[model samples]
Target: MSDQEIPAREPSWQSRRLLSDRLDWNLLRTFLVIGEEKSISRAAARLFLTQSAVSQSLKRLEEQLECALILRRGPRFDLSPAGEEVLRLAEEIYGNVSRLAATAKNPQDDVVGKVRILTISQVQSDLYDDFLIQLHRDHPRVELEIEVMRSADIQSSLNQKTATIGLGLCRFPQTKLERRRLLRQRYAFFCGKRHRLFGQRRLPLEALQGENFVSFTSDQLGGNLSPLTMFRDQQGFTGKIVASSSSFEEIRRLIIAGYGVGCLPEHLVDIDLHNGLIWRLPPAEGVVDVDVFLMWNREQRMNHAETVFLDSFRRLLEAAGEE
Candidate 1:
């Protein structure tokens, strides 16, 4: 990819000491607000200052930096080259300061903010459940919003910084994301009660040849769930896929409703297997092992609740791993 042409900036800084002596935190904060709001009047309203006062702050910041911070006309506003760089640095500074405040809070203090999690369906695990239960008991004021999304959509959301956390299968390691293995799940082929092969045990690998199949949309993506697709190919199943879905529950419903045999997380189907609603199929020995990951955008500036919850959750994961 070609590099984007940046707006020309000043030659170079003369001395770090000189720059630090003249720079004020308030000026940088005001400029950051102007860059975000894109309007002097709006920024003044947010900062609870007069419009002229805000304009003076920006002018002071530009003069001290020896470069134009914002290029503004009668009403239109835009960030100059130096202004863009300053805004980024200012955001980083503020994020660190915010994190420090969250860190220094008393343990008894309430952590109050929302954490939006974009995840794939059927993430049933003891560790995950324990995390949630512990989170509620410790930080009752923290709010969580969970949304079930496709693997592709989850990745997109995290990249755009629209979602805070992601949990599920992923295609490959995204450079901007931080990931940890949250669970190692076993996947197995299963048939509904009404299927002819249901309840069968020790069936040969050839028995499922040309049998109809049901699966998740991700299975066809060539990225996520590559193991399931590879296993299907290795088993020599040439059957047409009768149904597919992005949701695990929907795929499970279709398979249990007798749409076709499908691969699902083994632990999630324990109750169904016990009740004879679905029966595990052949090749019982070499089940597919898929690692579910906990992922978040490295660029995102998380809220107080997010910072606290993740810290506690990581400790829980570490403790579990040691056992």
Candidate 2:
């Protein structure tokens, strides 16, 4: 055959791999890392991948989408509008895929793998201490890792597969994770001993008006109504929050330090209430109530250890219900 007359060969399977036909899980992760970092080099460091590899992944993603996902400018890069949208959708898809994969994996009998549970500091303080004490006593073979993070982090932890379970005030959105509402959380408005409301048998809601208040941040409000929102809707709540924070510990200390009247979960401040360190605001109709949930990503094929752990957790939650 003449040098240029030979028939052209078909593209190699590797070259013909269709991005649309198969999802590249790593591509979504790479997109998220790069979007968060805004620099491929930085993302590469975070992902433990070479800059060149990161670049290749981006190229694949862009080629598959037939659009520029990122705009390179000098030493920096930013996602285009489309890229931002992709990132959002990719995150959702990644979460779903992870859940599917997790459920499909065969369980190991020994169950030696680490299990991560995400929760808030207060939940840990009020409930998990007893649970963990018993867990260790009964299941010494199962190693447990607990992460005390915010509610948002708890959601993200389960969403990102960083934690196998999440225990928090709010239930996760529709996902593969099964959420069981464990108990109702009650909040009490309270103030230091020096406050007028402290000595009263039951302070009127309006009486709280004009009183300086310390409160949780909007995010920390979780699914419950914000204190400010409660005050606006309820009569007799004339309190003014001079400071706000999401940290339960900080809020506790602030009230003790005489910052302002604050609301806290009863379990969190039960001891303080008894010690006279803080006094509850008189009960009012339609007070804020929160639902606490225990969420776990279930495996399609649960190992013996995983099954046992889940059962133990369910039992603990059930016992909490009795209290």
Winning model by lDDT: 1
lDDT of 2 by residue, 136-213 (tens): 776566656677866765765565554567777563354656777756777777788876666787566667667777
Clashing pairs in 2: 103-300, 205-236, 205-237, 206-236, 208-239, 209-238, 209-239, 210-238
lDDT of 1 by residue, 1-323 (tens): 11111234564657445888878889987876777678889999989999989978877776667767766654586776777888888866654543443334446766877777888887887889988998899888777889987777787667656567899787588989887778887888898998889877778978888789998787864768777788888767899899998878888889889988898888898899999899888777645888888888888888788888777777777788821
lDDT of 2: 0.67
Error of 2 at 277 (Å): 2.8
Residue 84, model 2, lDDT: 85
Instruction: Give candidate 1's error at residue 282 in angstroms.
Output: 1.2
Cα lDDT, all candidates: 0.78, 0.67
Off by over 4 Å in 1: 1-110
Candidate 2 worst ten-residue window by lDDT: 1-10
